[model samples]
Target: MEQESFRERRQAQAMGIDLPLGNSPADIRRRMEAIEFLLERSIQIPGTKYAIGLDAVIGLLPVVGDLIAAAMGSFIIWEAKRLGLPRWKLWRMVGNIALDTTLGAVPLAGDAFDLLFRSNSRNLRIVKRHLDKHHPETQIIEG
Candidate 1:
């Protein structure tokens, strides 16, 4: 059975089909967590309870900053696409990034927006929902 499965996977790969192998739910979750940390809350504000990440720090660089942050945010979208999320869901994720970038371009306001928006985290949630609904094996059931 294993040999047949391996043979079929190889055939699929040879045919240019991207198959999800060994990408268990745990792996996806860990990826999401890392992305969230990078884009959302990797640093804590001194003498304050608020947290921030690279996304906000990068967004502080004027025009180029928001662009860089948007580019980083696209990573989550790319992962969602790899997971075979529906078009609408993908669009929604794009919208989140778009909104984050658009509003994040507004100098002071944009930096604040980046601090609060956390588009990567939102995209991660969308990916998780899609995985739970479409890929049962990737779902992490809680007691």
Candidate 2:
């Protein structure tokens, strides 16, 4: 059963379909956290305390790169909307994506900005805050 489920998820992803993380708030939170981690903090800078993920690395491809990153970032907002986040909060998340994409398009300077401004991480914070306050049971004790 588990293997079948995994295969289905892989197939869906291959075909550009997005499966729901799960039906529960906890499941959604976990999925969003994983996405955020992948997009913003999956890689370390070898010798420095700084870290970056696919967002920064892929943002080096000029226009196409920024668009791809923006699409990935938008997934977080979509999840937040699914969770019924307030309209204003959802708008704020959209603004983050816009700013990140706009400034991240600026050649050398935009690439530098991607390293410092992690929009996905910011959106994850908003999602987490909502989960922690409203669905306290979804909270994970990070050590």
Candidate 3:
């Protein structure tokens, strides 16, 4: 089972406690996949056929939408730290959030931006690729 909560996994890593399948690539893939669900929207979503996701609906909450979504992006950043992603790549992940938040803050445009940008999900994929290259649990520090 893939837990989409980046905050929870980041905590587990910081504690040096790897839950079962928590550090596996499959788990990373699954977590990253959640971003997809969050970015989904209604009205057949332009390019996509279906229309549904936490992001579009959540944005309707007003005031809390972007903040909550941005916080979710932070989890990906935190996970990158624990998983030992390279600084360059890590920044790229951070940039995703920066861009996402900026556009998501707009009025009507922000909603459109959130639907298209999907920063949290995109950042997760970036980190996910790094995890696949080097299994998080098997990482060994080499000074």
**Evaluated with TM-score, which candidate comes out highest?**
2
* Local accuracy of candidate 2 as per-residue lDDT tens digits, 6-75: 9988975674444544769987887787778778987889999988998999999997899999999898
Best by lDDT: 2
For candidate 3, the 10 contiguous residues with the lowest summed lDDT are 34-43
lDDT (Cα, 0-100) at 53 in candidate 1: 87
Error (Å) of candidate 3 at residue 88 is: 2.1
Backbone clashes for every candidate come to 0, 0, 0
lDDT by residue for model 3 (33-140), tens: 544444443235579676756666566555578777777657667767776778998888878878877677788888877677766667766776676577766334
Estimated TM-score for each candidate:
0.76, 0.87, 0.62
Task: Give the TM-score comparing model 3 with the true structure, all chains together.
Answer: 0.62
Superior candidate under TM-score, 2 versus 3: 2
Residues 1-143, candidate 1, lDDT per residue (tens digit)? 88987887687567444343456665655566666776788788999998898899999999898898888888778777777788999999999989998899898988877888888888888888777777767676679
lDDT of 3: 0.65
Q: Indicate the residue-level lDDT of 71 in model 1.
A: 89
Which ranges of candidate 3 are over 4 A from the true structure?
1-21, 35-48, 136-143
Cα-based lDDT for every prediction: 0.80, 0.89, 0.65
Preferred candidate (TM-score higher): 1 or 3: 1
lDDT, candidate 1, residue 26?
Answer: 55
